[model samples]
Target: MASAVKDSRSGYGTLLRTPGAWTFLLPGFLARQPFAMLTIGIVLLVQSTTGSYGTAGAVSATTGVAMALFAPQGGKLADRFGQRAVLLPGVLVHAAGVAALITLALAHAPLWALLAVAVPTGASTPQVGPMVRARWAARLGAGPLMPTAAAFESVTDEFTFVVGPVLATALCTGIHPAAGLVAEAALTLAGGLLFAAQKRSQPAVHRPGSGERPRVSALSVPGVRVLIVAFLGIGAVFGGMQVSLTAFTQHIGQPGINGVLYGIFAGGNMLAGIACGAITWKVGPRRRLLVAYGLLALATTPLWAVTAVPLLGAVGLVVGLCIAPALITGYTLVETLVPATARTEAFTWLTGAVALGQAAAATSAGQLADGFGPSTGFLVPLAGTALACTVLLALRAHLLPRRSAGGAEAAAGHLPAQVSAGAEDRERELARA
Candidate 1:
């Protein structure tokens, strides 16, 4: 049924016609304002207070690790108790942690206080990404609307990264070192609360006290394991690329514009993501996903040979075009595979998988760059993408099953009734089409 979702009307304008789509997307945008700023803001905040970049890096990493480890738990809470219930408390805890961190920095408190608070800050992250994606899946069901929403979120991600770090850097240096962190806390509270208020769109939660463990965890589902692992590889590609791109720019003596070039790369993906959503895709989601991964694997290899800056930028654009499509398709596949009851957790695991891959690849690429050169570091993303392609290839039958009764069962999953209604609606819509 997911594979059957197609659109002859080829434009983003159609998506806005869904009633209250803007209501959901706008606050979702607001909810993300603090996330991009947090890591850099933490780094700057700690460094300013402690005069130790190492400590700053450590604290930031601690926050990230805590966030990663707890994300699934947060998702589980959202599944058991509605999104609003989970998000409201997350809003408070996250804001308080950030506020405490800022106050400690200003007060010149000990490093341990800063480190301790970072855990709650990360743990209490509102999980806006997963929540919003789940909401889209619930509202639109397994149709082109699914991919469009995914692409829109992907585009939003690009926009945040492009502007977020710049804004954080400016606030930290221009105002006070604590300014970005303060702003981050304020935005977190405002955005989180606003988003929670939109309770009408929230996905139905699994009831409490019916309390046998779920028949299948998100990871236990067929094809989900491969999805998580493939995402890990994709994440590594990103992490490795970040390090390699930095190295390449410095090699060319244009270290100053590394961010500019990265932005161009992201811009290419942003446009491609939108195009991928707007078109009527005849190819199955699995094929499109595999093709995108294969393209990324091939596109990144030339980075090892190219020495010119402009050529590198051009190649980066090519590589960038493949990423969002892969991500958009991946989310679509996950929607088809995961039962709606476990949806948020399934998506959170996907995010965690990527985070893990990025961390490992970033470390490896940094080492290779230090040992050999920056261009050599390019091998990391190339290798990562190849692995992703390999994983997708291995899971092809499971991930992209044929259109038969078995396929319908796989796509229908064991979703709860409230969630399954959306799937049935999509099927009826497809029949009309």
Candidate 2:
């Protein structure tokens, strides 16, 4: 049993050893950090200049909404064109937009001007996370290493969330209100350019003569739509926690403890992501996703009733632990349910769903905390997951790949010929690893 466990954990090491993997992985990490930093940086700078949290949140929401709306489109373009073609101009535009936003905030410009610039700032943000996942798919195909890669990427994402806000907060508070944005812009430009230059790692573009069928929107896939809804619920958990934890700390008269509480939650997520990537499971990703999400809902149920700090921290840790498995499994399912051609767009859609869900939950939870109490805010996570769990139960069949008359996997549209062969055995092997 111990030997099996060690073998399972070695999967990540095997995946990282893929030649040329580090070239893109390093730049991708740097580029993806901006996604976690942008909203917080904007909030800090705008609040410092205007002395209004309300105004600051509004600007940040504008950025989030814009990013959610436009990210899939960017992914679609990258699919039809190439990652470099889209990302090169995207990083430049994003940098300019961030500069404009910082300049406007410092000049005390009207909310309208800030909103205008926020659109481009968010829309032009490089789709590095999705692009990186697409690269993993292209490089690894439908192999055992794919799942490990997904888990690794989730761990990377969790780490960024942990680090990005802290770094942004420190820069804005300790250095200058504009320092966070400045650092964010610099990272986006440098990291994005470096990531884009790795053409060998980028997924092949599906042009007319590339022998690929005309690209379709990833949303057309039934499974992709279902996953989006599931992800939205997951986003609610994050958003609810952010607001509720703050309100809870304030309610307890130790508002400063909010950061520490949230850190415990995020830390659990990172640890779980690492462990999840290390251990090979015997269950299929579809089954694992359902089970993980159910556990997530169950974990969140007790949150509204907890008041003590230590107890809250423990529950938060459990809830965070539940999150990474569901997330990693969901991304793994995308490989089986979406075609290679639209995989990047599918990834972006799931990511966008999470952002949109988080924004909505934060807004609703904040209002609830203000009207009722922090405990009421905690209800958002439970409600979100419960509602999503219901949908997942009702339409769980959609999560499976479609098989054709010959008993071959259809996988939404179609996978590359090489990936289609023996896909099930590979998936089962991945599960057992």
Candidate 3:
């Protein structure tokens, strides 16, 4: 019985039992690395070619805005037109945008041209993380399996952040930035196409209720709104961390080794995510979230003290470990709170919040680093996390209908039960239709 209980908690065990799980999960991990490489490569290429950090930054900003603003619409389109219909067009558009950005950057076209091209690039890019999570939830119907899947997604994301920069830097510096962009375009097209091609990967179709439009905005939902704010804070912390790392590495006379150090940092996050999945069942969601955020704040403070390269790297790894579980817990909370009709959009909003926060932190921290030295970059994430903690703490009572997440006892009223009913009703109708 003890062995059976242990096996039940194993993420791989749960995944093995779920039919068609691999068809969806496999593409995400495989496709993400290439996609991340391309995305980072393009960003590096654009920034290098333009010779204007401001313009390059603006392009990123445009992309974030597009992603945040149009994410729900994109999700809605998926609901209305099927995953393939939404995904293929978005991929082609992204391919075209990358081509244009590369051409313009190579040709030394005006900065405005790049920004114009970039907005759509950002907007059209599918919500890869959210889509994957939603698909998993749709398949497994959420239990211990959901946390395991969340760990997988977080670890994959960490890996992408770790490797993509190195690949981008190597390709851009070794060959030409344009070569990197071209590679990115190809990967995006292939990954997007491949993901769309899998029949099991399609989002479950739902029957609409009376007075419900096929199209709806996630902004209209209260729980989604709070989650978005939380994600924004999270994004800010991440962006600040990236800028801080870049500046700190350069400051310590090892600008060249920043990528390698970042990889180590990412490795810690991956480890933390995997571990979190195994133990998350033991802690209630609220406590896990509170502890994660509190620890993240504490982890960040030591960077302000470390001066030596070895110490910095060690401190960074410790700090990075706090990120994944915090993120996973936050996402799980959203799943438990958001309405079925708005789940996709809510997830997108969370993604957008993070993107926006990252962009904001990057800009602010980069500027501060430029003026006051790289060490100043720590100020961004340090303050960002502090603010995030305060805000979350202040709003904890109302964030999600006062339910205890991951607790064995269900709340009297909560969104997860509603989602379950919706899924059941939709499944029945699909059989009939």
Candidate 4:
């Protein structure tokens, strides 16, 4: 047991030890906080100023939709030009947009005006998470370390979600209504600039050579499409749990416990992410993704029936624990299935899909909770994951890339130099086993 524990942890130790890894990772973490903070910050500030949750939600939804639509375009540009070129301008525009939105909100500007500024704010939000993943792929390549990196990033994402909302809420309530947006803008500007400046670690831009095929959109790949839908289901689980937990607490006459219950759920996700990163997996990522997703479906199946708070918390934690493996495995498959050139774009697609899905689920779940009950609201996640799992199982073949004349997938050679080295290392490890 001790040997297994040490083996599980060694992957992260070695991954973090990679030379120059910290340069971008630190700033990336700082920059990513705004993603978690943005929607909640907007909702809080707008609700305080306008005195209507409906209006605030509309404005926030506008921002989310704009971000979801434009993030992939930014990723494509990053792949074509370079991360620095895109990120520098993106961060600046986002900061300026945030400033404008805050000012307009304080002045009690028209809803249309706030919505207009929101477009730029969200559209210009830096694609920091996807860019960081691209850096890891460039630095570590298609190797065992890549899975560890994906797990670490997933953990980071879960952490930001856990922290960001709390921070935003505190700033909006304790400090000033605009404090959350102000802090979000400041982080975006500072962290994004620092991250963008790390040119040494950025993926090399892969412009087509003469007579080569023109670069295509990442969505053209069937596998990317499948993964996007799968991610959407994961997002639904998040949205559903948030609403259902809040309603459950309110229903039980202990509204304050909503935060605690939700914390337990998200904490489980973070712990699972840490553990998933530590273990050295023998099973391939494709199999892991399917199994993890199925388990997620199974775990969520009982949510609608739980009446006791303790049982609810226990079930929510188990559901949270099931999420990380699916998320990490899905990301690992991206490294193998997509070419290096379009990888950042592919990551952004998945990220955006999650955002879109979360927004939709939250809206629908909120309605179900309001109209029917908290228990009915819990159905959204179960329905979402089960439906997505069906699609994933039906289209599982698209997950694997086609082999080319050179006896490797077309994407195999397009990867970084470290990929071939990692393949060789895998062969040695297998032989030893």
Candidate 5:
């Protein structure tokens, strides 16, 4: 047992020591927390204040759509200009939007006013988390540490989801919603700026040979298309999950219970992600990714059976078990499949797919919950997961990486100097793809 524990610790220790790894992971975690917090907080606060869940859902949906539409552009900017250049403007735009949200709420502005403000706020969304993940691909050269890095990113996402709502709920209810939004804005500013300050965190983009025209499209890549589908499916699940908590709360005749439920759901993802990161695996990446998706599908099934709020929260915790590992593995695969130059764009595409999924889910879930009832709305994600599973299976051949024949030679080639050369190769491949 002691030996096992030591082995586990040592494994994580190696990951922690990887150059530029911690720098990329930690700041993005901090930055992403506020994004999750503000999103949940604003929806709850608006719904509570205006006594109209529909309007709140609409605002949230709008945010999701805007995020989806603009994310690809954000990725392009990050790649072409630089992470710092792209990030600074995004931070400011997000901050400004949040300020508008706070002001409108405090001023008792009409619902339309809030919706209008939420659009730009979503557009100016930071690329910090996506950029950070891309940086890992550049730094680590994509292998064992890729899973660890992806797990780190997933856990951070889960952690934010867990804490964001709780903090937002407490602040909005305890103090003022405006105050909560302001605080979220501040964190975005600070975190985005801080994240940008780290020179090593920027993604390495290599310009191709003379007269080489820019790549026409990321969609041309078979791997990118597969990953995008997975992202969209997962995104739909995430968006539906958010709405489902509220649906569960309302169904239980205790609308306030969603905060607790969501917190539990996010909590499960956080713990599972951390544990997944700690484990060292010799299994092939394709097999690991398949298992992750399968677990996600299996874990989601029990969620529909939950009726009571407490039971709902408990079941959600169990459902969350597969989320982080699945996401981490998927992201790791994305890093392997996509080239370096298009890395940021690829990440953005991933984010956009998720945003589109989230938006679609939010709209559909909200309407279903408000019209037919919350129970059916809760089941939509289950169906979405089944769809996702089919997509994963169908796309498996293209999405999964092939086992390299060189074995030890391939493994050893992932060091620092190799990282630079690999990035250059990735750029050329991305251009061609």
Candidate 6:
């Protein structure tokens, strides 16, 4: 029975067998809903009310920067205290900020008022991505199945991205501009609180409580910086694509349907991530990363000519295919790079880098879209992909770990739930040492 489950296509069956999986995974998915909705919501709301794309972009950028600057500290706090300690308060603050933003936007508040409220709002993001992944890592150690789990999670994330924007737009266009953010505020409170409450699956907080030798920090590692920078470049691609797509939709006089097009963009990622989970990967992380980067560069360049909605959606689908697999590989690499103790913080740092890149791209791309045109803004994503490809090629070796990550995991006594005979020998040796 176990073997049959393990051999099942996609490995989701095996992944979900962990105790209390659904209890937490459901809320985690809901918490991630805002990841896609909030930005687009802000963009649409501020643009419509204030009649300034540049201001809209600037506000989004402020939120991104605030989130970027505080994410690591949030993770640090979670590591030191506990997930509940950090997350419970974080969610409420975030909900309040979103509510305030919506009310102020509807009232047509001053730009400075909106921007000031947005800073704290963005900073209040509850560290959803890292915390959820950390829970999975704790439940299923870093091993073969870990890849499948990451892939599945990536697929879920893609689905959230697909639905979030569509849902946000529906509420905004169907109901009111402020309605989308109202929903966001509700989800942040409900989903975040529920997710944090699932304490059973939460990873054990790792902190120096006493005179125990301090665990090695992820930042001190050599290759980690490179990986973070790589994530930054990738985030730039996403940020530019998002901002440009918004401009493109508005330019085409179909701003309401942009959500469907964006959803299609994520639909491809959802499909690819599902397939990626079903198959066992033979390629190492470094090689897979380069190939993914190559695909991103190739796929995004044609987006330059995407004047029509269908062409843009098709091209968006193509580019979307590369995102999930690349993110999966990056997650796997970051997990392997850090010690088990620092996994949450390490993961959040990757998000921080991505947020930072998104901030820069959104700010600049919005200006480009507003002044030069949406066509010019599209160049940012293509340029970002090209630069990321270049960086990955130049620093491939430097970004790779010096030692075997699997072996290190074994040495740390963090083997998977099921170990093959070949792995058993290594596990035994590590045990003896």
For each predicted model, how many residue pairs clash, with residues at least 3 apart or on different chains? 0, 2, 0, 0, 0, 0
lDDT of every predicted structure (CA atoms): 0.73, 0.82, 0.66, 0.80, 0.71, 0.77
Q: What are the per-residue Cα lDDT tens digits for candidate 4 across 38-143?
A: 8767866886798654466567767777787898999999999999999999999999999999999999999999999989998998889999999999987756
Worst 10 residues of 1 by lDDT: 400-409
lDDT digits (tens) for residues 208-292 of candidate 6: 6586557666677666777777778777776787788878888888887778887888888889888888876554555667788
Worst 10 residues of 3 by lDDT: 1-10
lDDT of 5 by residue, 149-183 (tens): 77777887788888887777667666775556777
lDDT rank order: 2, 4, 6, 1, 5, 3
Off by over 4 Å in 6: 1-10, 209-211, 404-433
Q: What would the per-residue lDDT of candidate 3 be over residues 173-204, giving only the tens digit for each residue? A: 66886776677677678777887888666776
Query: What is the C-alpha local distance difference test score of candidate 6?
Result: 0.77
State the lDDT of candidate 2 residue by residue for 241-318, as single tens digits: 876775676578875566567778878889999999988675666667888999999999999999889999999999
Task: Output the lDDT of residue 222, model 2.
Answer: 96
**Top TM-score model:** 6
What residue pairs clash in candidate 1, if any at all? none
Checking candidate 6 for backbone clashes, the offending pairs are none
lDDT of 1 by residue, 293-404 (tens): 8888898888788887788789888887878888888877776677767889888888777655655565566567767877887787888889878978876666732232
**Over the full model, what C-alpha lDDT does candidate 4 score relative to the true structure?**
0.80
**lDDT computed for candidate 1:** 0.73
